[model samples]
Target: MLTALGLLPLALLGGWSLHAAGDYKEREQERWMLDLARALSSAADAELDGTVATLTTLGSTPALQNGDLPALYAAASTLARAQPDWLGVILTDDSGKILFRTMDSYGAPQTAAPADPDSLNQVLSTHQPVAGRIARGPRGRAAFPVRVPITDAKGKLYTLTAVILPDRMVRLIERQQVPTDAIIAIRDGARATVARSRDQKGRVADAPSKSLVELMRAGPEGIGTAVTTEGQQVATAYTTLSRYGWAVIVGRPTDKLRAAAFERMGVYGIGIALSLLGCFLLASLLANRIVRTIEALQQGAAALGSGAPLTLAPSSIIEIENIGKALEQAEHQRNAQERERAQLLDSLNRALASHQTALADAREAGRAKDEFLAVLGHELRNPLSPIVTSLDLMDFRDEPGNRRERGVMRRQVQHLRRLVDDLLDVSRITSGKLQIDATPVNLADVVRHAVTTSSGQQISMSTPAAVWVMGDGSRLTQVLNNLLSNAERFGSSATQVTLTVDATHARLVVSDNGIGMSEELMARVFEPFQQAPQSLARRTGGLGLGLAIVRKIVELHHGEVTVYSAGAGTGSRFEVTLPLSAAPAPEPCAIAAPHVEGLQLLLVDDNVDAAGAGAALLELLGHEVRVAHNAAEALDAVRQKMPQVAILDIGLPDMDGYALAAAIRHQAGDTPLRLVALTGYGQKEDITRAYEADFDLHLTKPATVADLQRATAPLT
Candidate 1:
């Protein structure tokens, strides 16, 4: 009678276990479907985000910013060719007039408007990117546009759009490993199908069934039963992308899901029935023995819980013995895991310490490098000052026979100066301290100045009367000179430079017929230390920083530069485009040397060569000059003879130029002394400091005769 009573409870427990198994299976399937929906939603968002980013980058191009439709068309064509999933790229005015399309050739008239004008209007109103609804695109294929706004140089609004084919989204959905019978679809905000796992191309743009639409409207994400467009009822899981209001729906047929649950329940029921029957038979045969074994197991389990060693006696039943063995193995594993965790923690601490140490070392190394570059620039500029002064003096003398020699010497000096300047500019650019002064500048003047500075090259020039742009004149001239010098260094004897102006942009092209760069060399040509291969002599000598500086400067001015070559020995071409400015070009003025002569001046420099050369040049320019080698000498000269002007070098042996200037002022209490600071420190901070020290003028080293004439002109 006791066995019969126990069998009744066992049967009840088996029935409960079967029901629980079926419930668990259904819940598990629902969770899996939800996870799959979330994954698909994330994938779709990523793809759309990529398209938006690409459109943003394209809109920022100088061609688009300057309203150069042909250039923009070319760029769009290249981009479309590169991306197979892009159906076309179009640029339109705010009124939906298509200005250019990649599907059409350059300058081709396009009358067809975009399929989705609401998205373009949204972009224009918000000035942000928008992903449009799927529709029949211009080519009669179903696609969507990813649109971004572009404000041109004149502040006119335009929309740049990339039409994306639905196949990409279809591929994204198909890549997910889902059940064969499952249905997956991505729907736009309007409930139109964008992509579906089954017959995507055919079902695209179709409206979802009423039931599915109701389910989607219920919440941002949920699981429910809905009838698909195909009239099949499914258990659907959906998640909405927050950015674009798109939905990723994953569903399995309701009948199939129910069938799976029922199958699991049946298997569980059969297993439970067999287990109950076996237990009953065992109870009938050996109930007393089983009872004793159960009591022993209870004791052993309690002992293991209390951290006591397990001790189980031999049992006739193999399953009971195996259970005891498993308990013992669990204890061993716990202890082993504790030891392993401690070791792993120690290793992680050591690795973290090492990483911190490496990071500190790298920072220290960067500081040291910056300091070295500063000191090197100062040291190199001191010698060049004397050389440049001497060259100017030679020109002033106009010795008849040495014209060619003087020209050669001047060119070499200028080259060395440029190299030093490039090094300093690189340091500034790396530290994010390089700055430009923007004003209305003419490209014709820039070309003339650059050609004069880069004299030896046979450059063919073509430019309009005036092409105005907004940038730093000196920096723009530097950019052109670098290109000219690069061509001369790498090209054959002949180089050509051309300047063309459109309505909103100016194009500067420099071409050279020399040994062209290989594809590998061209890839990294703008990197700081990248250079083409050189022979043992290295006839073309440079630190390989010119082009890097060019790129940085051009970008700072909101411009673009590119290089092209067909192949080796086929020549090379470089193009630079900058937005045009409406500001009119300034009238040209001829600056002749000031008529100041025979003014009493004191020149102070620690370097004897620099001071002597400078004094000689001043004397040749018809000025009476006294040379001083230190601040004390300068002060003494001021006391002995109150000069009209004092050219002070910042770095001196006894005292700096700032203090010396103050002393000289005190010595000549009421007399006006024009203080000119001529030093190798040309950084912006240094210039600011010089002005703060009551100096009348500040000139960097290697000043030309023209610079000196202007400085002394005020004194006269």
Candidate 2:
């Protein structure tokens, strides 16, 4: 019953709102239609003034009087080209024989002129400005003709100038300030558009167009609503062209106006909906309170019938107030039961944390131990890659038992020796004994020597003659050798390794068509023990230490290295930058002058066989040879013979090779003799120790036979 009471008032309010909204909307649309009609009528007046200016200019031009028909034709042509909508312009004698006419009834250029006596008769009889009936124009276009008298300087009328009105005015009415849903036009009393916008089908029917004809006939100050023959209901307004005796009528669709009215009505409907909603809310609230009171009292009665405790509600109606006191007692009992359950859950969480602590500790310890093993493996594996690549090259011998294979094996052994040397280098660097012997050196000479000595990839050098830099010759050569070796080992054999020398630094670029690296690999390629780990790397085997050493040595000389790659299959390029140095001049020293008389040479090694073998090799290069097993014996030989070259081993038993070299240099002041250290300790720091001890040259264990011959050749 309460629900029904609430709904009754809401229904009445909604109906009233809808009716009011509809009435308001109708008034608004009527106002909008009136304003639109006025704006269009005013635009037509401006067009008439523009037509007058066009005609006056053509008649007054001096070029028209000389009987130059082309000049006059050009003037008329200019006006038409400037305004495509222009119907045509005609100049005629007072008798109405056409003098010049350009109105083509068919879509063709005007070539012949024709006169109409009927049009002349009307003009003379009216003795006033006149307009002609709408006629089909070029291309079936429609236009209207307006005629005015042309007079001579003596005030005697000589010609008639008629302008066919352009149709753009009608098109302008249709598009400008006109609504798409509304149809509008400017027309004469006979009802034809001077200009028209075409319909979608390229045809505009006379029926929809007929409303304008009716409005125009009604004369100026006309207004009406009619269903156009085209099946549209529209409102039209008209005003006449006072100067031309033509009427301009504007038609707008009536349904569009009605729709606008309905749109306004919807706004009012919203307000009504809101008012009705407020009434519904008020009624619903009152009904709910009454129904709830009755429900509570009925429940209390049921509890009493069952002999159970009853609850009372605090109702303003007072009948159910005692029910609230009974409910309060029941709620208190429920709260006590909830408290006991929560206590058990909290106790369980505390026990779990204690049980998991030891397991967590054990996992962290295991992770730390694993990281240590990975670093150790990387260090051990770094040296083995270059050796593997060199060894693989050896096994590629085409024939069994060939001496060529022996040479390949020897190269692989040298590769193994280099790997061992790099390991010792890392140790020496860590112990902080790396030293530099700065000298003014010819960098171009060093480049030629390095390129000539490097074995694998195709090496080329383009250096300016006599270019120089400051660096230790042996170490600089070592730096270049390392770079060249890495390029040959990793890049393809056919790759071109180029050495470019400049004023400030030398740039070495080693490029290969072998598999390139992605951005990720290029980033870490020079990092210690990091190489491309793809199948290509397996084919182009390396421990990756060569590039790392190359980078470190270049850095040691204050230069840089940059790598570029075009991604995986494209091939990689490595650039090594080295500082430049100035060339040195020959200096006077204590050692005997260059061989006017043959200079003696001494060589030493802890391995007696290596000592004899090296001396024999030196002699083959045309150098006098003296062999010794240790540096002490080599020094004693140096004192006895004062040899021009002394080659000593670093690991000699009696004393270190570095100490012995120092003693020989001290005994022979400013010795011109080249003190070459031949040793197994070929690490970078160990070589630095040799230079510091005044040795002029440093050669590693198992140095290539060609390398030994070249070192001795300088002394000879």
Candidate 3:
């Protein structure tokens, strides 16, 4: 009786444990199958979303907006060629008349209408993209259409469709690598199989089993037993995509799952039988010893609870001995856990302190960097201002035999100024402070201005009358100059520039027969500081930031720039595409030039050289000029005789330019004096401050004769 009693609980425990293990394995398998179904559903959604995006982009193309069927066909053909799974691209009117198809030759008559007219109608009605049902494509294969609606400026609607092959979706299923006998399938909203992993020969575009359809109708996702189209019973897990009314079903054969469970149960049964037999035999022998051993174990447990050392002697039974050993180990683990927790707390404290310190250091470093850039710009421009003034002075003189020297000096000075501007622009770009002063700008005028200012090999140009785009004209000019400069530096003998316009976009292409880039250089060409390999001499001098700036500025204008090169020694081509804007009213004929010469002016700069050279340049320009080295001197001069204009430097030895300007305004209460801020600070904030301080104009250091003349011109 005692042996049986002891063996009974052991038998029950073995059975319970085996049942729990089986249940756990089954639950885990179900969870995995459900997860797989969700993953497959997500993949299908991504594919459909990608097709829709492509169609949307194509719908916005300039050729389509302008109703240029041939150009639209060509563009669509190029896109279709890039995607192997794309059967063709189609365009249709709101009434479903096929305008063009990439599968057909350009301008070829198309008799067949779009494969899915209902989806096209839906898109036209909703003004939203749609994923159409699988149907017989133009190629007489199973395909589906993704449609996006395009509306012209006059609100006329058109549809753009991309016919996609179903085989690509089957490829998506194959990539999941489901079990050999398992079934993975994607079904469209109409309960037809779009793609299947198994028995796909005649299964695609065919309806799934009635039972699976019933399960799909029950919910967006669920797990249940269903029969597949192949007449095989399966444990099916399914999920439906939210974006498109589609379903992804993963079905594992029920027979296989059952076989696995039964096999595990059989193994557990045999083990349990053997264990019961062994326990029956041992129970007889161990029952008598168990009571005494249990008493000793109880004592050890009490001692352990009291935090006292275990003092139990060795026992004949292995389990009793193990119990004593466990008690001792438990005491040791307690001490170790306390020590580990203390160390962990200390580590966390140190880490938190370090993080705070690093954050403060980072903020301080940023502040210091900003200060350094400002100071660097100030120091660099101070010297260039005097140089620019001297160059202007030379321009006024008709000195013989000095034209070449004068040209050399002027070019170098302009180059230095560009470098400074590029440096400052980079800072603004990184800090996200750069802004575009958008206005209707004519590309023809921009190209002309850039060509005249660019000093290099004569550039061949071809442009239409006027291609208007909303952007900053000066920034656009900078983009062109950078491209021209890049060509010149790379040894281009012949450079050609072409501007092509359409109703919605303008494309500017600059091609040069230069030292073309290698594949490695092209890969990272737009990254800042990326440059071609140079010798020690480094004849091509640049900071390698020109292309980087070009890309950023173009992006600001909602445009794109790309570079293409046919390997080294071949050539390189750069293309910039910007969205077109409606041309503004024709600018009024140029106003008569302002009489800027022979005026009374006051030039103030803390740098004596800058002030003196500026004064000399004004005097040479047939103007009465007075120079001041400080704000106090400027005020004194203004008090003595109120000049027509006062050009004050922001950085002064006395009160700063803003305060001095206020004082001067107070002194000349009624005098209409124009205050032009001529300083090295050229940031956006500095310009804003100039206006706020009542300054009529703001010009950075190194202002050219044209810039100075414009600033000194009477405000209109």
What TM-score fits each model? 0.48, 0.35, 0.48
Model 2 regions lying over 4 Å from their true place: 1-403, 428-449, 458-480, 491-508, 534-539, 577-608, 615-677, 682-700, 703-716
What 10-residue stretch in candidate 1 is worst by lDDT? 1-10
lDDT of 2 by residue, 148-190 (tens): 5555444444343454544556555656655566655455434
lDDT of 1 by residue, 595-660 (tens): 565789999999999999999999987889999999878878887789998999999999999999
What lDDT does candidate 3 reach at residue 407? Answer: 90
Q: Which stretches of candidate 1 lie over 4 Å from their true place?
A: 1-367, 400-404, 585-594, 714-716
lDDT of 3: 0.84
Using lDDT as the measure, the top candidate is 1
Full candidate order by lDDT, most accurate first: 1, 3, 2
Best to worst by TM-score, what's the order?
A: 3, 1, 2
lDDT of each: 0.86, 0.62, 0.84
